[model samples]
Target: MTSRLKRTLLALSLAISLPAGAANYSIGTGSQSGTYYPLGGMLAKVWSDNIENFNMRAEVTAASVENIIKVSSGQQLVGIAMGDSVASAIQGQAPFRKPLDVAVLFALYPNVVQFIVPADSSINTIADLKGKKISVGAPGSGTRVGSTAILEALGIHQGDFKAQSLNYTATTNALANGQIDAGVIIGSAGVGAITELALTRDIRILSFSQAELAKVHAALPAYSGMEIPAETYSKVTAFTAPAVWNVLVVKKDLDPALATQMLETAFGNMDKISKVIADAKNATVDNMDKLQGVPLHASSQAFLTKMKGQ
Candidate 1:
């Protein structure tokens, strides 16, 4: 063959052997402006940079439920799930029609359920929220599910309160503007949105007593035991509230090697990620095995095993 033709043929063969963009995998995150989306974007950037031949991307999904479904179907490679919700998704529990093959990449930080009442409001407890206007978080969010569950545990139904399906920003605004009596938020202990609201306006966290947690935990085994430490939020100087875990989930059948790399990347970058979100500072190798109810994927388990050994 002519020298030019031989060179052209060789280039074509090399190109054909290459797989798709190594740094181009999609992560299904939550609402456009929420923690999950930005967090996912951050992970995509970090992991894409750290891992070789595998880039990452992010998609705004309907938080937990939709993300799990999409991940299970392989529509999205990664998802951020509330621990309880992830467990339910794996077990095919409520809100999910059937059992799904969801696996944990690794555990993220806590998604604390904060019950907020006006600073001067008399609604100090969950029971007091009855007949009060409340923002129970955005539609299809983990907050919504947890709020609904919390209300149920407190023997308070949706109808009992003026349920507003608003996002954290909206909820903070609505509460500040007196549009709602209480706002139920599911986020990190040091959530930016929550802190911003607390700066000027005095707020107190509605502490969940043991009985309340008992009922909630009974129905949701996936929830991890948590406490909002004293001074964690200025709004609650010494608040002690129950919290839940968050999980990095994936399709059960995703390539194990890819999953391992992702999990390692997540935990390895724990400090950097924690800076992106307040609760994440606590994310470490120690927490990788603590998904509560959601089971870890084989690849993730293998990584955790190595992490533990090290």
Candidate 2:
């Protein structure tokens, strides 16, 4: 065969073997016990089921910090991250060594800073946590960063507490088995582990006083004040806490059209997601601006603008 003909045949063979216009994507979400994984799974289902020639999968990761690293490195096509972490990733702040290029898709929900203790435990305030066994959060998780920052801001250094780095499920199990005195979980108001723990054992959700919250704002201005209603948990009444927006982000180089399509698909079926995870109901186009730090993906910004005009 002629050299040019052989080359043409090889190219044709390759094209024939590949699925035409097929795209495969992976979404990095938190551990299985957290809301991000389930919600991401739902989105993956939507994308796979609805978008022709598109295949997506949800990966259970170490949560926000890991998700950010994966998506920024292009190991994952998409990820859910805390607003502060997104900012931190871009600025090459603590927990991130070098600056990462990522773009925001939309703000999904608020990750409330939940300081939980046994209902009967005497740890009433952040100050009461001194010298106590506390699960700051798992290593490489955004919760860890926030927990450290908040504690340091309140003048409670790492040495002040018997710090245990555990994930949401592990934290819940540790607290319930009497292995830990307190745990900090930054997630949707009624995170799964907390709700499950409250079902069998009384749990106390600690609220930050206004002064404490002000200090949090100073330490991480990305966090905003949030309130968890009395009915959200079993034994806890209303509580005031700090929260940061949880945003969907993509690789900075992702195709704008695909980003916009993914946004529309996820938000369009949000009602389905909310039925399973109530926190997901908070996802809406109007709240897109809640995403700060990283700039919105160009396509997402254009989509939001188009939504606003309608």
Candidate 3:
């Protein structure tokens, strides 16, 4: 064949083999040690593998607040955010300048609030945290937002305690080194940081009193009381704590059809995801009821309606 014809043939072959208009997307997740990160990675893999001409990756982020901002700005295609953060953002609450255009794809799982302190510490209850140094997660993390709300609801205002904004790993380290008196972590039941800390040092998971939980619920209706099963972490017993369901969200302008495809792909592969992230087992069509306050993506509403019918 002529050299020019050979080049033409090569170009045509490449076109035939590669997907037309292939697109790359990213899912914004939390710290490397958090549940969101691994869940995001699993999603990226399954979505990329199942979707034609689409590539997806999981980006490590500061979690909910940052994820919401980045997803709204189109920096990331999707994000996992706590329901409380989503509600606050939608209402143009603090840390967000104005209501952002974001919609939920589906509910993931409940992020249980875990109050960690040295096992033998004198801090016995939420009220005892007064005047104590506490790590309430990173500045842009949902843990920070939710923990603050919880503390304030119980009359433990910022000035009432020395509040520190640190990520999960940092919070764990600070606790181990006696840098903080207590740390508030809102994550999946088997959160790596808390689990690792429990293994190396004796730690306690504090529970809320009925009145305290009632106060929190009255102040922030988005939070619900839940239990962290015994043995979920070593050296810890079952305890009741506040929890907020985590939701997968996409930007408002994302294509409806694409959103539908993504949801279908994820729900269809729940078995595979659950194998990797135990919390994923709770990510089901039935749990769609858990997602509240946030507007559902048009595609998600339709898809969920169709699934519930079947």
Per-residue CA lDDT of candidate 3, range 34-118, in tens? 9999999999999999999898899999999999999999999999999999988888998899999998888999999999999
lDDT of 1 by residue, 132-236 (tens): 888887776788887788777668987787888998888888889988898978877777787888887888888877777777777666554466776676747
Local distance difference test values of all predictions, in order: 0.78, 0.89, 0.91
Query: What number of clashing residue pairs does each candidate have, in the order they appear?
Result: 6, 0, 0
Off by over 4 Å in 2: 1-21
Clash count, predicted structure 3? 0
Candidate 1 off by > 4 Å? 1-20, 32-34
Backbone clashes, candidate 2? 0
Of candidates 3 and 1, the better by lDDT: 3
How does candidate 3 fare on TM-score? 0.93
TM-score for all models, in order of appearance: 0.86, 0.91, 0.93
Candidate 3: worst-modelled 10 consecutive residues by lDDT: 286-295
Q: Rank order by lDDT, top first?
A: 3, 2, 1
Whole-model lDDT for model 3 versus the true structure? Answer: 0.91
Q: Identify the candidate with maximal lDDT.
A: 3
Evaluate model 2: give its TM-score: 0.91
